[model samples]
Target: GDANRAEAALARAEGRIPDALFLIDQARIAFLEHDVSGTEDYWAACRIADEVGSTEIWLDIEVLATPEEHDTWDRLRTLPAADRDACAFFRRFWNRRAAAAGMGVDDRIVAHYQRTRFALDHYRRRGRVRPRFAARLGRPTNSVYDDRGLLYVRMGDPDEVAIHGGSDCIEPNISWAYDRPGGYRIYHLSPLAGVDDWYLQENLAIVYRCGSWDRNPMVAISPLLLDVPGQPFHDLYLSRMGLDPRYARIANHALSLIGDAFAGSRLAEELTVEREWTWQDGEYAISTVPERPAVDLSVDFALEWLQFRAPRPGLTRVWLNGLAEASALQPVEKEGQDVYRVQIVWTLLDETGLFYRFIPSSFDAAVDGPLDDEAGLSLRKSADLPPGTYRWMLAISDANSTADGQGKKVRGGYAGGDVVVRDLGTDLPVLSDVAVSADSVGAWSPTAGISLNPTPARLTGDDGVAFIYYEVYNLTPGGMYETRVVLQPEDGGPSFDLSYPGTAQRSASIVTRGHLRIDLSASSPGRYEMSVTVRDLTSGHVTLPVRTDILVTRD
Candidate 1:
């Protein structure tokens, strides 16, 4: 209802000033209501209304957002109004995120708003923002959030939070622990500038230091006084305690107080560590956590991809066909059946800021017969893309696995390499990548009858014959052509080659498609490279042979 009214008001306020003012008001209202998408939309609209219209309105938006989000808004504001590329990026970023979360974009937007709202309500500073503590709290001095709010914006609420009031000798501090996905992260926060203004303290010693002794000017203070020598402070502290009974008491107290499931010994150990450090002014240094780098798991898998000219000009149809071993997947029981679920993502990017990502396949395949050591599930997908030089990545992950610290599902198999798609000139005969099938073929692109099921692992079981499909372009009328297929073992072994002469059945302007049945029955089971080439016998024109590797399994 409010959105409708805002739209009506915006339509009425056609001028730059009125529209900007109205949109700014709507943005603030949305921000207060914890509507991140709405606020961003209104903010972007206002900026597009007039880039130089009002600096005050930009300030208003920044004031309402977390320091991190303020940077995001600032970047968007500086871009040209209604920039197509920027708008596309914004939509793609949110849409891809929504797909990964297995929800609609709207739901993802709502969830993000909820997280920010929680931070604003809970982590915002209760008192005035002190200028001296601004850098310690986060960026943008006008932000109302403390250190906790800044952290919350970057990483959603920690799995466990504990507010520990200072004992007589210790300083008041807050402890946070994340133990689930991306290993363990334990953070400590101290009120560096009074009660309401908190700063992230890298020094664990500050939490339990004797305030009186540290303040004494006579004591020779080393800058190292604040630095704890151990990483993952939880382990080293407990190790230093050396079988102290106090560990159990602290753990039990923490479990009871914070209701953290993993708090038994871990939290207890951390708490004990907190109480052991001496007070010192540690150099305020913030740790830089890299944003969501892909976690690649060492898993056995195989991939084969082929590309052909798409129906539209300047676009190529890409087909990815491969299989993953059963060991690479985690079997989860669903509806009385143990099934392996996996999510496959393909991403393409270039230095020119071109980015395209798609979830090609996601499915739960039920276990059949033995959980094979060779191959568990077959993976295949087709997509049409424009010509470009891109670094492409294909990621396959166990869908049942828990999300890592950065919220990406732990990937089981990952592969990346550079790829170049170019326009196939009509003047020369160019052959597409050979599409091979161990079994039967199916319909695909280029032509209605061109579908071929690419063999998994490039394997030809029981039957020794491999079916191959390919298209040849720029043919002459009634052209006499020779199609040659070769099977050569990577190992120094005997090779097999076949050449068949045929007349072009299609017009010179159309692509000439053909298939071959290569007998590999007598060949030994091993890895072989299959290459295909077509030659115009009458015109003495030949194509550059395209080759793909295949793994032939024992019958």
Candidate 2:
């Protein structure tokens, strides 16, 4: 039967009527028929219709959604024509949902469709018949008019259900409750138009209605599980639910559970929480606050660094607040010398706050005497952080210490900072901030290549050469590009240009290096400006040049 309906829809699509509704019908029919590649075909048709400014087609797609979802879709579609691509919008929407669910988009969508079909079959087996009006109009029997069907399609099956009102003249209604791993939801439904078509009620208020209203009656669900951990989504859910005060406590409980679970994971090896009694001596505590100075969205990472003074060798604990995974303290050697360094890598989707604490080991207490001077510890860590402004607190503490002569204990130190992560547009070519390194060590990182050890911007003529490092993104793969670095003296002297021919790779980013040499015997010492430019030879597209100031000192 589905195949026959698909064939009819296909025939209508082939009529060259150029109607958006007909094309969408064809796509939906293909989906119903279990055509594997039909979704892409539907996307192609929608793209063409969008290019032709088919507003009616976009509206038709919105009508297929529940009232709340329809409102969201309509608002997105109302964006400028250039910003509205049906396929891209839908893909992004599904991708975001998948990310929130910690699942893949394709798998999630398939599950949704399968659940929809299962709901239809379930109602059919229960002897629920479609209304005459819906049947005559050729509407799907399990359309949104079927409240259970709609909920099942969006969120799978409910964990529990209850039927109410079987006495007197009162019509019977059903209540569905879901206790999903990600969240909870409750839906109240009643039959409409004296038919088997059930629709969600507007609210708890009892009212007799013949048709559906614009307001969606279903109680909005909030994520309640530890596994689904995105603060942005949680905040959004809270806002949508009118910010109930009780949710704050519930969220805190959930986070604690998540932390407990993470502490048992393999990643938590050698990690132990300090007991309250063991933390009695606070005088010898050390603290460091994490700072996010720069964020690059093009690479989906943020630059986080912190500096601290450790009075004694101790165990360090570092983790992102409200996250399930934490880093285990490992041995770090700098310049063949053992030191305390903490590195944390995070993604844009991760929670913002970072917690770090230090506890002195017994060995340190035996070997190293009371710390008289601060042993400075500085570290640089980078991770992906989505574009947003966040206020975060970095707390550091000394876990090993004794009370002073007066039995007075000191408290741990904390610092707060505002971090703003920016997004670089993908449509245009851009360059990262340039850093000059005298000698780089360690392995290459996504944010900073070659473990750059930055030196002062001043270059003496006797230094021979200075190495510059920068990254370019969104370059056309396989295209020939020219990179030019020029140095101009501040006193209106002639400029020196260093040019290099490069081949753009298939990757979205390219790291570049430039070397500049100054001869004191032949040049005047003054402030100099260094500029870097990249131009694509294939398309003749050029990026806006970036410049840095350098001081050329007399050797």
Candidate 3:
């Protein structure tokens, strides 16, 4: 509700003052509320105004936000955007906020979630959960915009734009008064062609002229999306050819994929009457064909050993696809059954990272009821889940959960529409280094993932620290893995390491590139280590072993 009120206030400000600060203020309000784009734009404005000072820029003022305020934006622009921008912003902000508050903000991300929740009671669609959750940004639904829902984001607040505001000398004498921070002003001098003109008070350009708000949204698939599979394909689609691609990695990737596939080269041919789809948009099947030509084949199987148990007493549901007979969950073995299945191993994972081969929660067993059931899918069986439309995926067999050695590998899979178990969690300790060229980020853009070739950068600064984190996956059961990384310069210059105890952890750990930050002041440095040991903990077992060498250094 606060965001809605703030938005409404901002919209009305466009009428009250034809300045940019009001819009910028509104954007700040959204940022304070964790509006992803709003936070990004505000910081961008704030940073740009400070570093590249110009009369036309209306963003964060160095006089108010200080040089430190612009520092975040400066550092953030180097990131690849998306959550990266958001993450960097908070890291910078919290550092400042902590200094201001005299205490550190919790580093655990999910912990800060509550403070960001939206007030659904206000400025929400008639019957929706949370605003963004129920409403797609660009898609037409019961949203506020139709078709393109055109929007323009500028630097600062619109109300603060200066212009003639007096009734003197027969001319319109209007000028913005409150040009300082903490206050936003706007002027609604006039509306033209049903579109009102508003500009920021400071640097102007903080004008926002939103089209007629749509109560019943016009539904179109969004051009913004994610890299994960089973997601609504956007940005990369044929329709979003002319859309803004900011923060649209998934869509951007798809667009790139399409380009690589030369989809445009065959656009005219694919749209012909004879070359249509078996499933139209939104599964609105418009075809007369009895069976779809593409039948995805798969299998399901259980691991040879497992002690499956749920955390609490709940319905043990069994589902799979492919073959004729169902799993052994319910005995009475039927004839002609294929035994290939993908079992979900949960014990093997946790948020910190993952070890290989954790036990599963369910195993194959014989049931007394029903025929050798056909492969199937499942959803929450009431009482256990909330009431909402949740999508799910089904597996006919274990093969559905996996691909053959020759076939492409899929990182994750869905048991039902909602329960997605990605085959990937943590990568076995691969080395990566974080190297910041300068203490003050001014002209320095930090680089990571260092190598031994070419020219290695010299790391500088007091308390200069390099973070080396490795990801691990598919570890041997009960078998421990250990690897020691050595840091050194190519020409026997200098190196560093984590001081003793803090440097080591069972199986995996993070260590300094070298013990002395001064050692890395050389022109070029190389981090060299020989032999990484990865052991599977299982006793007397021929466990599959995987080793990953992590290269961690401060560039």
Number of the top-ranking candidate, with TM-score as the measure: 1
- Write down the lDDT of every candidate, Cα atoms only: 0.58, 0.42, 0.27
Compared with the true structure, what per-residue lDDT tens digits does model 3 show for residues 157-250? 1223233222211122122211112222222121111222221111111111221223211112111111221222322221222221221433
lDDT of 2: 0.42
Give the per-residue lDDT of model 1 (tens digit) for 1-555. 255676667666657555556666566456546566565555465445554434544453242234454566667767766552433444544444443333444444555555556667777877764434325434457556776766565445554555555654346777654432333355567774377767666444444443244432212321112222222223323322322344344434433433223223454345435433311111111222211213345455677767787777767877777677777667887767778887777666543532545445686778654376756576777777777776566667777776667434364766666777656644788888887777656533436755555654666656567777888887666888999978799896988998977788667766778876777787888889988889998788999989887667655
Q: Which ten residues in a row have the lowest lDDT in candidate 1?
A: 278-287
Clashing pairs in 1: 182-405, 209-279, 442-451, 443-451, 444-451
345 Cα displacement, candidate 3 (Å)? 38
Candidates in order, TM-scores: namely 0.61, 0.34, 0.18
- Could you tell me the TM-score of candidate 2? 0.34
Best by lDDT: 1
| lDDT of each residue in 464-530, candidate 2, tens digit only | 3455555555678777888887889898889988787887776654433333232433556677788
